[model samples]
Target: MRIATIGTGSIVDEFLQAVEQVETAECIAMYSRKLETAKELAEKYKIKSIYTSLDEMYQNPDIECIYIASPNSLHFDHAFQALSSGKHVICEKPFTSTVEEAEKLIALAKEKKLFLFDAISNIHLPNFKLIKENLALLGPIRFVQCNYSQYSRKYNQLLNGETPNVFNPAFSGGALLDINIYNLHFVTRLFGSPDDISYTANKHPNGIDTSGVLVMKYPNFISECVGSKDTQGMNFVLIQGENGYLHVKDGANGCRSVFIHTNDQEVNLNAQTSMNRLFYELAEFEGIVQREDYSSCYKLLEHTLEVVRETVKARTDAKIVFAADKR
Candidate 1:
């Protein structure tokens, strides 16, 4: 698939690198609010077209799809524009600021007969697939704990009365949307939606959640997802069960190493070899688009919508309100 990219952030760099690994996908055009930013990335990736205008990019007949890595606030607009212009979209995580936005985008994609994907890396990773396949080995699950906490460089700025987009409510940026969303996708993709969800958050003066703990209650077990930008911790995912337990050493974002432990046996299952986690999702998107597999794409879109619903509930319950929430 011939693709265009919407942002020039660090994540876009990672996506560009992953594109190199996916033989079926190539980024041909880049868009940025600033021409210099677009040119810099275009030059690095050897992309021929640099678009400073979204309208211009949409007008380009050569661009078949768009990979949106824009800020949280812009996802809906960017994805909508791409889809409305008859282009498939591979959107970054936290698909939209609200479930309504996600639903509209999904509907538009269907209306246009185009592919819409939530670019969640873990769901497509080999190790993640292994975890799902081996879940039976763990027997009946009792509890799940996922911790993905890192001290954000911008967190210090927030302390000194500076608001980065990552910590700003108006931009729909916070711990739950930024870091914890990964944990949500990982769990929901594997086990489906939870029976009940609740969130308690540590908020900045700006009313944004700097850190939070989300609890998802299932019929069988309770899952705790802890995500923090205000503090740091050892990042990992632990699943305890009746027979054995499964552990992911790295975190929900990247399943670097997976280990299964039972009473009598211990095994290390590391199926992911690629350094770039984004490669898997991009490759999967390429396959879906190439084969016109809308059935599979919509199934994943349904999963994304479920995640968005729970996310809205979590944020609302915690009184973490984004500007989009009012809309």
Candidate 2:
């Protein structure tokens, strides 16, 4: 798959590393608002073309796929343009600012017969897959707790009366959308949508959540997802079941060391060998596009939609609003 990447953020560096490991995908072009930024990444990745304008990049028929790692506020517009221009899109997660934006993009992707992927890392990780395979061994799941907390460098800036995109409501930036979305995907992909969802947040002065706890109520189990940009801690996920429990030590974004423990024994499962967490998802995207597997794509899309719905509800109920929510 020939690809064009948007944005030259730190994530793009990790993405470029992942692309190097995938035999089926190569980034042919890069786009950035600044020509120097695009040139910098292109030189590092050996990409041939760099464009300052998205329209110029979209017009290139050689670019079969568009990888968007733009800001959270821009995901919908960037993805919509890619889908409309007949290019497959791998959008960075927090797929869009709102459920409505996500639905529209999914609809356009279906109409255009293009592959649309939310670039979530954990779902494609081998350890995460192993968790699903051994879930039955844990008997019936009773509770799940996921905590992904990192003290952002931008947090101090916010404290100093400055707003960074990650904590800024104007850019659809918040802890839930930024970090907790991974936990949402991790839990919802394994257990499906919850019966009820609610959020309690420590809001910034501008009405964005700096830290929050998302509580999801299932028929039999209660799941709590704690994400914070204001604080830091040891991030992990614990799934409790009737017979045993599974623990992930490296948080939801990268399921690095996973252990399953029961009364009988404890086993360590770390199946993912790649240091670059983005590689698994990029490889999966390549296979899906190669096989034209729209069914499987849509199945994942449905899961993403469910996540968007629940997260939107949580944000709304908690009175944490983004500029996109008004739209």
Candidate 3:
């Protein structure tokens, strides 16, 4: 699939670097608000086309898909533009800044019969899929606790009066949207959307959450999510059941290995770090486009939108509003 990337950010750089490994996908075009930025990305990545305006890329007949790695507040706009242009979209996580925006994108994609995917790449990993298939081994699952915290360098900048994009409310920057979204994904992927959810966050003076603990309640068990941007925390996910426990020591976005500990035995998948499973997500997008399977992509996007929908609801119910929020 020939994809046009819509942001010239760090995530965009990483994606472009990784696309070299996924032979089925190519970065054919790039678009940004600045012509120099777009041209730099095009020249650096050896892409054929670059557009300073979003309208130009949307009008480009050669671009079939758009990958949006822009800030949270812009995700909906970019995805909507691509879908309106008769193109599929793969958007970065926290699907949109709000559930209503997510719903609008979902409805529009359906009306246009296009694919809309969220780039929560780890959900499609082989190890995660395998764990799902063998969930019975955990007996009756009781509790799940996940922690995904990384001290952002940008957070430090915000502390010293420099407004980095990560800490700026206008960019939809906050601990919850940054990393807690992954924790929500882990919970929702295993147990579906929660019966109820709440977030207790450490708020910054600028009205954005710096660090937080999110709670997703199930009828039978409790799932806890810890997400932060102020300070580093031990990143791990644990699933405890009647038998024993399952520990995933790695972070949420890239879980390389997992350990299963029962009363009598211990097992490890021995998943090496070398294999860049992110390639699988890109390949799946290409596969869907080649097969013209918007329905399949829609199913995934529905799950994605559900998670973000709950997150937005949780934030709203908590009365936590970012300055960037639209009334």
Write down the RMSD of all candidates, one decimal each. 0.9, 1.0, 1.8
lDDT of each: 0.93, 0.93, 0.82
Give the alpha carbon lDDT tens digit for every residue of 1-327 in model 2.
Answer: 999999999999999999999998899999998888778788988999989889999999999999999989999999999999999999998899898899999999999999999998889999899999999999999999999999999999999999999888989999999999999999999999999999999998899999999999999999999999999978999999999999999788899899999987999998888989999999888898899999989988998899889889999889988889898
Worst 10 residues of 3 by lDDT: 269-278
- Name the Cα RMSD for model 2: 1.0
Off by over 4 Å in 3: 38-40, 270-277, 323-327
Q: What is the C-alpha lDDT profile of model 1 across 1-327, one tens digit per residue? A: 999999988999999999999988889999999988777788888999888889999989989999999989999999999999999899998799998899899999999899999998999999999999999998999999999999999999999999999999999999999999999999999899999999999999899999999999999899999999999899999999999999999799999889999987889998777989999988888888888898999999999999999999999899988999888
By summed lDDT, the worst window of 10 consecutive residues in model 1 runs over: 35-44
Candidate 3, 25-123: lDDT as tens digits: 888998888878777667888998878878888998888889999888788888988999999899988788877788889999889888888998778
TM-score of 3: 0.94
Q: Whole-model lDDT, candidate 1?
A: 0.93
lDDT, residue 74, candidate 3: 82
Residue pairs of candidate 2 with colliding backbone atoms: none
Clash pairs (backbone) in predicted model 1: none
Candidate structures ordered by lDDT, highest first? 1, 2, 3
